[model samples]
Target: MTTSFQKKTRSKVLQIPGAKPSIYNNQLLISTGIPSLDHILGGGVAVGTILLIEEDTYGNYARLMLKYFCAEAVMTGHSLLLASADADPEQILKELPAPIIDDPGKGEATLEEPSHDSSSDNMKIAWRYRHLPKFQSNTSGVKFGHYYDLSKTMESELTQTVDISTVDSSLCACDSKQTDGEFNNPGYNSLLKTIQEKIMANGFSTTTQVEKRNILRLALHSIGSPMWGEKGGLTENEMYSPALPRFLVGLKAILRTAYACCVITVPAHLFCDKAYVRRLERLTDTVVEVDSFVGSDKEKNPVYKDYHGLFNIKQLPCLNSLVCNMPDSLDLAFKLRRKKLTIEKLHLPPDLSETANRSQEDPLKNLKPSSGCGTGGRSNKLEF
Candidate 1:
């Protein structure tokens, strides 16, 4: 005569190292290796997305960012696949920046420092603003990213813990019988195939036989440059080639069904056609461009004297929802200090000092009248 009910149990999600659920949508995300960049990217990059970085004029800062990505993989016990045509992947791995560990003494020292402004302690806050929350660069409960010391190289023992695979496009041979079409370039074809194989063989795919699952971090450096045999945007006739775009399509397809993410740096400054660049931007999930002021006039200007380059966010993808994660502010700049590369909201130092001579001689009073001013003649100098 009695009725019984059974309790339904929910499935537990597996926790992966170096990965965390996004605060906004609960989607799995991985850090880009730089803490500030991860904050700018809205709690790190979402899994299975492509991050396209347009190389700066000198390609120095872009390359440094790529190194950070690899260093994070090493520290977090994630798999890494580095592909490049110009430089050896082994060499790149050897130059990863050392990870910085937090020290309790340093924190205590900072807290014990005296305040510089005496009146700041007595300043009053409005009632409405007092209840507002303080600003934070990272809002996640878990620490997903680590800070790196750019001046030091990672120790070899720590780097050895990571499983790494490298693909050198320079060593790949092209097929003589292949026709010109999608993935026409042999390097592109080989790179795409290598990525697919790595995903399947390493159990990074969704349907894998392996028991434990881990994320794969792929970094492709200086793609679409002359060394990759893509014409480097030298001529207008070759600007619209479908090779790079088609390759990206395949790469994106591979990432969607696998537990992998990619960061690719392209020499976008070489491409002359705006439409072709636009096409490339449309194919990627996230697009960021770096404009370095190394040898330009901005390097000498006091406004940007503290910054090495500008960080521009061109596109951000919406994952599992209608809205995308937008950063708090777009006016951002990056600078390299002695030990770290940091991205922060661009702000100029306050010029508090008054001008030495506020009142000066007027320009009109300094001008003298011409000799023929009264005869309706064109005078070179005149007085108002």
Candidate 2:
């Protein structure tokens, strides 16, 4: 016979929050700038998350994907800081979509309000493209004229301007005067100085406070390159002077000054060197891998193309390739199947637009009907 105390002390099963995956509080996840790809990346990338992309020696313009994010941030009233370790800004701008290089007012269609209807959205897109400049600009001397104002009524109007100053490099890192001994990277220091000069030219004070109204997006490309291999540098330990650490410190400093951060990298070649990837991974909240390898499609179309559409992956060594042959939206799901590209719905966070309704109803019910999250994957191809 057990005593009363012993009965009370019976083993109780522990009831705790399931250790399943979920979104975090205070995390600002933004889109991958690619609608379909964003779903795979857990609903765009969380702000301040570090994104990695791998490019082979073939010199693919991997950075073009970044132009999408940069354009999105600017349209939404964010100031962007882009750091390019090896490429020239002008060259990078050239390969991007013409609309991205054009002013926002002239590029994007001005919709009075967003609609959930696919037909309406396509109509608006067509109208905007119709209004875009037909002939490219020939004059080298372009003026920095009045552009879109976030506070004005014309904020939705697209402009035709190409203001490099808007994407200047100098506005990164912390107070230019204060020096952390950790900022021992010489290449980073040089790049920082160039970036600083550009920022100052654009009328930014080195120590000026960046307001909450502006979401600041900063990207450090090719953060750790093997070209600057650890060998033949400073002493074994003192070689903490490449683009990676300074970028880490600079990114952290900006987080306090800005509303958000976006860091991009290419690790396939450099990161394989064990030492380089380990160092770069230390400075990130989230890491997203953007993979661009879509296998050859010789069966559907006889003509060959060097490149394929982009895909975002969890990156356990080329897992992103799973969706390379698929279309980005459900509307194209049927067409993509004809072309041989597959479609897969992925789990993601609640849409920000549905926040109010979500709060009033069961959050689980907010899932979109056509949303691919629960569906098994399918694929198709584009026939040139």
Candidate 3:
């Protein structure tokens, strides 16, 4: 659309490391690991961004997305994941799709066979005989990330850890000398401190090695749930508690500096307050709401018989960030089928077949009436 298209040099957007960027708005996309979803996002999510997904009224599909997001990180070489939901680390590992060794029809090519031209011994310091560049005739199969099987995650299946930091503890150890005020800061939670330290250690720098930088995919499921130390409702004593807000703000700050992106799902319906939801929405880079078609008759439905739930983008990412410039309003619905999970554009049900049948029979009825009439038809109203 612009002169950038004619430029001979390739943009960073065109050469994202692990996967192919979205074809729509290929600025700086982070593959979501879902094909239809990546297309919906105009390639994928933008790096240095936070996506807050509100669970459906039924609280069904959001968890699936959270699991897939984590699984994708594991597949795309971003193995260090910070999961803060009811699911345990083992359960999370199990949810990740297997490496594509057995299937050649689709998925990533993980097991690339070694060439037979290597020497039996190590080559010593020799003359100036350089190897040729690899010949690439086909560029069709670019795997962005892996997929996951349908999983049943349970609260009891895995023991959820509160102090969840998926990095080395020694790297983030506190200093020997520190003031009481510094130790007692509102953002001084153990989890937050550890993540902030890790971000600083791996953050992008002019002198730092970009190839070695670690990308962390953080997933926070139901943040206000019991796992994160929530005390009942958001009124009275609970209203004054600043634990969740402080942690989220600190995490946001951390993401901005590090090679990371986050997908968080919160049970917004439980709060039952517009102010709290809006406040949470304000803190995130993007916000989406999901809901089920509880009242609609599934038997009569046509367009979305395969759909599981509906989704809507509430707030778009701000223009100042590295994220893609996505369309403000988007309509989407998702469905789960066997090993496949899909999201598609939401649409109204198709027209009824009975209407078409009625149209076909009406002409026959009209002809019979005219044939049975005498010389002139005596009409109740004016003849047309």
**Candidate number with greatest TM-score:** 1
- Runs with alpha carbons beyond 4 Å of true place in candidate 3: 1-16, 19-27, 99-142, 151-188, 201-211, 231-235, 238-242, 293-303, 320-329, 353-384
Best by lDDT: 1
Q: State the lDDT of candidate 3 residue by residue for 1-384, as single tens digits.
A: 456465476565424355454455443567776656665565577777788888865565777777777656655656345554445545555554433323342442233313312431233553223244333221223365445556443232222322224422322233313312421222236666665665566553223456654456677666665444443224233453444556678778777766677888888877656777777788887888877665546534666676777777777775444654564336677677645566666665656765444445654444435543342454535544
lDDT at position 210, candidate 1? 75
Error of 2 at 176 (Å): 24
What does each candidate score in C-alpha RMSD?
Answer: 7.1, 19.4, 15.1
Model 1, residue 37: C-alpha shift (Å): 0.8
The pairs that clash in candidate 3 are 19-144, 22-43
Give the lDDT of residue 163 in candidate 2: 32
**89-139: candidate 1 lDDT, tens digit per residue:** 888999999987762225533564444233344457644454344433434
Name the candidate, 2 or 3, with the larger lDDT value. 3
Ranking by TM-score: 1, 3, 2
Q: How close to the true structure is residue 255 of candidate 1, measured as C-alpha lDDT?
A: 96
Query: Which residue pairs in candidate 1 have backbone atoms (N, alpha carbon, C) closer than 3 angstroms, thus clashing?
Result: none
Identify the superior model by lDDT, candidate 1 or candidate 2.
Answer: 1
